[model samples]
Target: MSINYPKSIENLIKQFSSLPSVGRKTAERYVFHLLKQKPEQIKLFAKYLHDLPNNFKTCSKCLSLSEENPCSICSDKNRNDKIICIISNFQDLLAIESTKKYNGKYFILGGLINPIENIGPDKLNIKLLVKEINSKLKTLPEIEIILALSPTMEGETTSLYLQKILKNPKIKLSKLAQGLSTGMSLEYVDENTLANALKFRGIIK
Candidate 1:
């Protein structure tokens, strides 16, 4: 069914629809909303889009997206350096931060293990994480690693692999429990649920 939209409108719809989980109808709605915006607002939006890549840089330590190297969280001296939270992405880190229950460092895995996608243990930043942990051990006697990943099959797989590689008597590995529903990403969980999960995190053994 052709909507008979003009070339520019159709192109905008196509671009919006290309985004994750965005359907054609949603894309059309987005395009219409954009069309309703003032020219100044539209230009500002386009400027932000154009400047995004250059403005944001991935943190060297945790791999989280930030404007500065080491990122604010990593560089913050007040945060507990002995406890490191391993997360799947920057969004998950933000979700946890919103709770204010966890005052620790973070290590972003970048992505989860998916055999179909050919994303194995080597594909992630596991090596860098291990290096960071080992380097930190010299200053700190003991450290806690929190596996703050989603409860999906890929999350489990990645967690298990991390457990095997990071097993150490001096290090304690734990994961968020109870309040988190199964198969839900941390990024989308409610603040209350996330807070409870952090409060009652379970030891991985």
Candidate 2:
């Protein structure tokens, strides 16, 4: 199981393999592909890697990965500030946005509650969500927060906790409709199904 490549190539392969779902063989292939690229192209690729963390920062407003602090969606005047869709992560937020059925703001919880995995409420951005909502309410008359979570047990647990913490007559809470079915991840759901779920979301009352 000896790797005969140069130290530089070996290090690059190891780094690539560290990425999610990438095996050592695939990482080697990627490194070889980069070797075939023009010198300028390789420099450009390296520059992009160097700049990724500097440019793509976690949005302060919605906790999403974006170039801007508030992110384009959070700062967009056309987006409805009165409605905020709380999703498990940035991918789920993208999935919902792809449907074009929702034009509301979003709050990206870093993850859902899963006690078995040691991921609790404190691990996610729940407190920041409450603070953001209260701050927004200062300007807006009222706001509706939708729990756009997955149908898994963890998602349910997170949604219930959000409901409990956000319980109030002035603030409204809701969840995606039954059409989403049970045990489906929002990130992998089809556009039509997700769109319908948003269209017919149910109030938490």
Candidate 3:
């Protein structure tokens, strides 16, 4: 346990350790691996990381990470605007998109409701979602809002909170079929399974 490494390398390890799921050993390995890389390559990587936070912004409509305001999906004319899929994060959005069975727009919640983490509905872009729904009702064929969130506790909490707020007679709200299970995340589900589940989404009670 000798602290003999250079200050810069130690600092890199600390930075990597701050990332999710990266332990001290993994961080050290990553720093050493980067040391083997060319100086220009490392500089480019560092520059990208440094610029990332300021360079990207969340999409106004879907809450997806993008440099543009609305993101490509929200602006795409070919996408079905009528059915908006509600997901916990961008990963779920990508999961559903991989199925190629859904053509609707999406609303990324950014994260789920976790009381322990103090992440509530207000912290999410729920107000913007409501505005989007209301505004689209007049101009689009928008009829349904599909709850494609995971079956985890936080996901269920988030979905119920949304349902309570968006309980309008004019708009139909539905949840994905029971095949997703109570604790499974959409990210791990197969494309065919996700497609089938979406095809048979049930009306939320």
Candidate 4:
């Protein structure tokens, strides 16, 4: 009735299983695969994983992960400061950026509003977003807010909450066009489809 694997190997498997979408079987496979690799390589990988959290910081403006305080996109002079694309996560932001059609800046919400999961506006960085908008209004004077969140229920709830908080006539608020079907995530949309959606965004009431 004794397990063949060492205690350390079992512990590593447990740790890997803790990751999102990784089950015990996959974790075991991963551990065995890593065991096959050279100690130096494993050491390097471990070092990188251990240092990642300390190495990267979130941008003050957009909350994107970055080595710098403000990410490259936030500091880019070529990007349009007049418009800000609001996305649920960094993956959504990357999806929009891949289209190469959107020239505006981005505000990453980190996640959507999932009431069932107890995630709400306060849990998100909404206050920082409002502060960013206020700062922009004072400096730029003319800016638009674009909601590029997913078409899911959570996404809609988050968008509505953000719209309510950022409701100012001075800021032109818009949402991505209906091209993106309901219940679909932006990350899965093709580049051309995403580009067209961006090109034809509509004002949100």
Candidate 5:
């Protein structure tokens, strides 16, 4: 589709269109909306976009993006270190936290196992996760892992792979119960449903 706007507006629209779920029409609307804003407002928006990458660092333990190295959750002394909730990404971690039903540490897997996309265990943070867990075992007497992944096919595959590799008599593994519907993403689920799922998590055999 050809844009009638001049080069500057067209370039801005193109950049906006490059974002996820944003088409040319949507990008045009976004650009027009910004055009109506005051110069200071637009500058503030540009500043945020420019500083986003430098504002946050990945937590060494959970791999969550934060301003600090360990992140507030991983460094929290009040949290239950014996329980670790494994999630697919930072969004899932935030979803679970919104429920306020869990007080455990977390490990972000980075991504799920999807053969079609050529993403596998090697592409994810599984190795770091395993190493982190085993290393923590020295301090914590026993550990319980809560697999809080989505109920999608890729999520299931990743969970199974984790179950196999993390198999240990000392470590107990469990997954969120059917409180969450199949094929649903945790980030979009309501707090009540997520809370129920965490409350009724089942052991994975």
Candidate 6:
């Protein structure tokens, strides 16, 4: 049975509940935790959330959200411009970056193709990726494109779709190696596993 929370508490609970993996009980706990915080703490939290829209800009080249247009990674000259690791989101990109093993460029696809969610190739950043690769090939003779997406069904579907669309003599496509647990998202994988996967990425046909 649901307790009759006050209107303000109920509204906050609903907002928290809408977040991924947050159920009603989890949301309720979150709200109560916030309520226990000092007023200044709550105000700081609200300020951060409110200022999020003004805080960052999406990198034009990779679509990663950062304080600058072309994120620090994209701006770094030391990174391998001939290689691009394609990921579903910023979280996964950070996961890969944390490994410190990869020295290549990155492209955030925004989302994977989940037919159940009505997401398809068109909904992702495929067009931009193709355009970027085509443009990069002009300056560079060859480019390596790594499909570093999650291991879930949607991830596989998106990878397969990408395999078909990103065809070019100069583009060599690869993906995370077989050791990753099936259906595991990259964000949750340990740094060692992620680093190994990048080190042993497999060629895609």
The CA lDDT of each predicted structure is: 0.93, 0.92, 0.89, 0.90, 0.93, 0.93
Candidate 1 achieves a global lDDT of 0.93
Per-residue alpha-carbon lDDT of model 3 for 1-205, expressed as tens digits?
A: 7667798888889999999899999999999899899999999999999998999999988988888988989999998888999998888998999999999999987788999999988898788889989998888653799999898999889889989999887689999988777798889988988999999999985
RMSD of each: 2.1, 2.3, 2.1, 1.7, 1.8, 1.7
True lDDT of residue 43, candidate 2? 100
Report the lDDT tens digits of candidate 2 across residue range 1-205.
9758899999999999999899999999999999999999999999999998888888899988998888999889998889999999888988998999899999999899999999999999988998998898889887899999999999999998999999877688999998777888899999999999999999986
Worst 10 residues of 3 by lDDT: 134-143
**Candidate number with the higher lDDT (1 or 4):** 1
Q: Kindly provide the TM-score of model 4 when superposed on the true structure, using C-alpha atoms.
A: 0.92
Model 1, position 199: C-alpha lDDT score: 87
Q: In model 1, where is the ten-residue run with the lowest total lDDT?
A: 177-186
What tens digits encode model 4's per-residue C-alpha lDDT throughout 1-205?
9757788998999999999899999999999999999999999999999998899998989998889978999999999999999998888888998998989999998888999999978888888898899989998767899999888899889888888888787889998888788899889988998898889999985
TM-score of each: 0.90, 0.86, 0.89, 0.92, 0.93, 0.95
Q: List residue ranges in candidate 6 displaced over 4 A.
A: 1-4
The digit string of per-residue lDDT tens for model 1 on 101-154 reads 999999999999999999998999999999999999989889999998998889
Ordered from best to worst TM-score, the candidate numbers read 6, 5, 4, 1, 3, 2
Task: Choose 2 or 6, whichever is better by TM-score.
Answer: 6
Off by over 4 Å in 2: 1-5
Candidate 5, clashing residue pairs?
none
Clashes of each: 0, 0, 0, 0, 0, 0
How many residue pairs clash in model 6? 0
Minimum summed lDDT over a 10-residue window in model 5 is located at: 178-187
lDDT of 3: 0.89
**How do the residues 4-82 of candidate 5 rate in per-residue lDDT, one tens digit apiece?**
8899999999999999899999999999999999999999999999999999999999999999989999999999999
> Local error of candidate 4 at 10, Å?
2.3
Between prediction 2 and prediction 3, the one with superior TM-score is 3
